[model samples]
Target: MVLGTSFHFDGQGTATAADAMKRYCGLLGEQEMEGKSSPQWLATKELVKDDGEMVFEEGISRFCPNCAKILKSAVEGTYPRLI
Candidate 1:
């Protein structure tokens, strides 16, 4: 049940999963090289009422005006979330 994915930098300027984990842990002030662990890294599995379906409601998914504009531009192929 992975909630999300992250990116990290390898020695060659590329992001890897292990590097991402280290960066994430470092953000929390936990020693990355000391073999320390954080509960936040653990994954939790849960059941949702709808299986493989998107539930949308009016005004429930509102975003900031600026963000919405940016997203719209992305949708139009003018902007990209990752560059």
Candidate 2:
């Protein structure tokens, strides 16, 4: 499915939060998140960066919207804020 609103990201940055979650889990678009966490993803959280490409991409979306903003910042190389 396509996004109705304009959205953008670069260098492996995903177009939406759900998309980010997919990348984080390394799951295919056809798959569900299955209410599970990725060990690989969790390990990355130990760093200030992820392969020098991203910061945390979705820190429990139900609780932290800042995660989305932080992902944008990580890609754009700027400071992020919660909102």
Estimate, for each residue in 1-83, the C-alpha lDDT of model 1 and write its tens digit: 21122232335453433444344333323322223222211111101212201111111122222233322332344532221
Question: Stretches of candidate 1 above 4 Å error?
Answer: 1-61, 80-83
Lowest summed lDDT across 10 adjacent residues in model 1 is found at 51-60
Clashing pairs in 1: 8-15
lDDT of each: 0.26, 0.36
Pick the TM-score winner: 2
